[model samples]
Target: MNLKVIAFDADDTLFINEPYFEEAEKKFCVLLEDYLSHQGLSRELFTTQVNNLPLYGYGIKGYILSMIEAAIKVSNGTISVDFIKKITEYGKDLIEKPIELIDGVEETLQALHGKYKLVVATKGDLKDQQRKLHKSGLGNYFHHIEVMDDKQEINYQKLVKRLDIQPSEFMMIGNSLKSDVLPVLEIGGYAIHIPFHTTWEHERIDHKVEHQNFSAVEKIIDVLKILQ
Candidate 1:
């Protein structure tokens, strides 16, 4: 492959992310357990979050609001102010969660840093993603960071144009097939999927992906085998 740019998805691709959100979600479920079953509460929270995506976009702040919205709906508007405060605290805790680098992330980045123009193409609140990259100590490896509002075919097209590279010369690496692989591949770019142990429910894809420019690997370090 004649790739000139290598882009990586930030969240679970570079470091630990989904598990922390899951943990916070469990707390949310418990806090509202009196009103509904854990499964029911999870369902409600998930629904609310998806509905709010267009309005609030994605991040801890939006999630915090979703939890509060879910809690109010479940409690029939009788939820106390203290519970709302606690829910807000959950989001703050998530924002401040320590950055845990994925195994072999640094090694993989080091191997390709100078060989190609590496950039971070991730979807989330710009500030949160920047903070995570800063905390991860992986900032210096990237030539640019694209904090997109969403990962879609058009988004990839825009990114390619901005980088001044042909679609065929760009490659994306990430944990989510829906956000990271499919969209990139759809735009005629190469993609490598390095699946994380846990994924967000919304990011899960029901169908297997098959593409000439796409490959799935067990770990981030394994990408070296293909790129080299």
Candidate 2:
């Protein structure tokens, strides 16, 4: 397979992300453990985050807000102000947390750096994504960085245009099939789905589907084989 530009997703793909959120959420659930069962609280929080996506997009800020709303809902407005503050603090800690590179990420990027026109095309709050990238010490590897507002087909199409590469010559690698794989494949580009250990509710797909241009690998290190 011939490829020109290779776009990689940031969270979960290159560094530890979903785990931090999952840990923070467990902590949040504990705060509401007295109000409702942990499983019930988890379900409500997931629903709130899904409904809030249009307003907050994606990031720790929105997540904190959703947890707060879920807390208030389950507690029926009797939750303590101190509880809210704690939730906010959790969000702050998550945002300030260091980026832990996924196993083999740096080595994978280093191997592919100059061989392909590598770039980051991740979706998140621009400020948060930029902070993570720079701190990850992997910034020097990419030719371009795109903090996408979303990863729909139109966004990927615009990216290909900007790179001056045809759809067949462009490929995107990421964890979420909803965000990274299907959209790129929709626009006639190749995509690789490298599933993370944990996934957000919104990123889950209803069924397993396959396409000629869509493939999956076990880890970032396996990307070298795909590129070859």
Candidate 3:
């Protein structure tokens, strides 16, 4: 009952998204091979660069732009305009599709709606994330929704200050140990981590959790027992 706000992460935390990107990657690879054959760009090299794009951060625009630039580089500026257009269109399609909300998210949010202030703090492509939130229909449950550029220690502090809530009074619920749990705990906030069934390999990391304020769970519905 002491909780003032509960901030949730979108994407894997609330719904399924990784699969879409994986599917898009397949389409992108095909386009790359077709357009870069003359420059001797192997599929393996293209895959390496595409997979590494996450290093620049997650966003549809950034991902597409980087892929286009890479294609241009490998093709020695001989790549066709249509190839870029196809990849960009594919990226847009990835976002425009409906999202599959994780089981129990809707019910859990409804249970906590009036009891505690609700918010969504997610990181990724702005347009894709925003559209997902809108499509999820859980948008109305949250008082505020933040689409962050990066989930670093400073970002956590900024969110706490923006929401005008003390660390002890707010809780972050998410799936990623690195981005979701660590940064929040670093600032003295509480966090409940629910690991997603499947995660991108690049997002993988080991987290050392020694804080009494942080706990991990297997599912979102389980939080109701703690809060109630």
Candidate 4:
């Protein structure tokens, strides 16, 4: 494949992440249950989150803020301060949640670690991402860690340039086709998609990918066959 630097997305790719957010979201919906249906509340919360993206960027902290904002909106300013506090606590609990590595994650990394110049090219709050990586006990597998604020074509371009590798020499593995696969493929890099059970709405796309460099696998362990 002529790949030298291989990157992986952090959140759902390496370990469990979406379910934590989903669980927190359920609590948030219940907090506002008196105001709206759970589905409606979830929609409102997502709208608030998307609107606040530029101000807060992407992270659990911003998500907490979105929940609070949405709660206030849904409750028409009648939501109690105690409930707001609980919402904040939800974000905290998420941050403190244990690292649960995806099945076959360690085995996959163990096989590919030294063979490839591995990296974590992920998007999120740097501190939280760092904490998760530390907790995962998979730190030594990577040659470098890039906890970027976002992952897009330009961002991937800059990353490739910084690493001094040609676009074609880079490979990315992740669950999100929007953030991880398309962008890397846009820059002429190879990307392998390892789908997770839950995907955030913002990370979802409708079109099918038709790139020679793009591939999808059934699980993390399946990556071994393609890369080998």
Candidate 5:
């Protein structure tokens, strides 16, 4: 493959992300357990988050709002402000959470650094993503960072255009097959799925993905074998 640009999906692909969110979600469910069962609250929160995606895009701020919205809905619009404050705190803590790189992430990046133009191509609130990337100490390795609103076929097409590379010369590596893999492949770019143990419900795909340009590896470092 004549790859010119190697783009990575930042969140779970590069560092620990979803597990923290899952922990916060567990707390959210417990805080509202008096109004609804844990399972029920989870369902409500997930539904609210998905519904609010177009409006809030993606980030801790949107998540805090979704938590409050779900809590209010579960409490029949009578949820207390104290509860809201606690929810806000949860979101803030997430925003400040430490960046813990995946086991082989830095090693992989170091190996591939000069061989190609590396960039981060992930979707989320721009400021928050920028903060995480800065904190990760992996920023210098990337030539650019693209915090997309959403990862779709058109978005990938636009990214390819912006990079001035042919679709065939772009390769995306990420954990979510739904967001990071399918869209890149749809736009004729190569995709490598490095499965994270936890994934957001909205990013889960129900079926297997098979394509000539798609491959799944057990870990981030495995990409070196394929790319080299």
Candidate 6:
């Protein structure tokens, strides 16, 4: 395990973003549903559209905007301009709030910082992702931070090639089996899946027992032993 570059996932892997989103999303959905109801739109229809917008992209701002667009279409332009303003403002607040790093994140990161080329390979809105990284104070520990539009084989392969690292010499430590473990293993890179107790629904990854380069841990702090 001659790891030259080690990338990590952001969001739940490093911090407790689910709770923040939970709080904001509840308010967001209620407001949207209320506006939709006032305009004779079905709440169920609106909710389905809102939830499915992730197929377009992963940003909450985009998701909100998509919801508003759907609402406007469903309302036949009945959605008030004032409501749009309010939701946009609230979305910005959701994007800019201070992120809370997960337990042992700092110590674990500090432990591996000097020993590996630390990178953040995460998925989300670029602006929001950068803001969270800037605020987390863990930004300095990473040489590169990739806030990708999607995590797929091509993106993961490009990252490895761009970093000039061979597959075996690179490691991806993250909480997602679908995004982090599978793709990295497909390219022959080593991946360590450190499962979080509360996996966000969006980040939930199905695991396969057949992957040779994939493994799991109960906690991230144990990653040091593998690297050592």
Candidate 4 on 1-228: residue-level lDDT in tens?
A: 899999999899999999999999999888788899999999999999999988888889889998999999998999898999999899999999999999999999999987989999987788999999999999999999998878889999999999999999999999999999998998899999999999999999999988899999999999999988
Q: Report the Cα lDDT for residue 63, model 3.
A: 65
lDDT of 6 by residue, 74-95 (tens): 6578878887787677677777
TM-scores for all candidates: the values are: 0.99, 0.95, 0.85, 0.98, 0.99, 0.83
lDDT of 1 by residue, 32-116 (tens): 9999999999999999999999998888888999999999999999999999999999999999999999999999999998999
- Residue 194 of model 1, lDDT score: 95
Off by over 4 Å in 5: none
Give the CA lDDT, 0 to 100, for residue 26 in model 6: 59
Cα-based lDDT for every prediction: 0.95, 0.91, 0.80, 0.93, 0.95, 0.76
lDDT of 2 by residue, 147-193 (tens): 88778899999999999989999999999999999999899999999
lDDT value, residue 140 of candidate 1: 98
TM-score, predicted candidate 3 vs. hidden true structure? 0.85
Provide the lowest-lDDT 10-residue window in model 4: 26-35
Instruction: Encode model 5's per-residue lDDT on 166-193: one tens digit a residue.
Output: 9999999999999999988988999999
Point out the worst 10-residue segment of candidate 6 by lDDT.
37-46
Q: Write the per-residue lDDT of candidate 3 for residues 1-228, one digit (tens) a residue.
A: 367999999988899887776677667667777654523443544455456655756776766666677677767788888987887898678767788999999999999999999999998877778788888888899999888878888998899899998877889999888888888888888899998877766566875677888888889999898888
- Winner on lDDT (1 vs 6): 1
Error of 2 at 174 (Å): 0.8
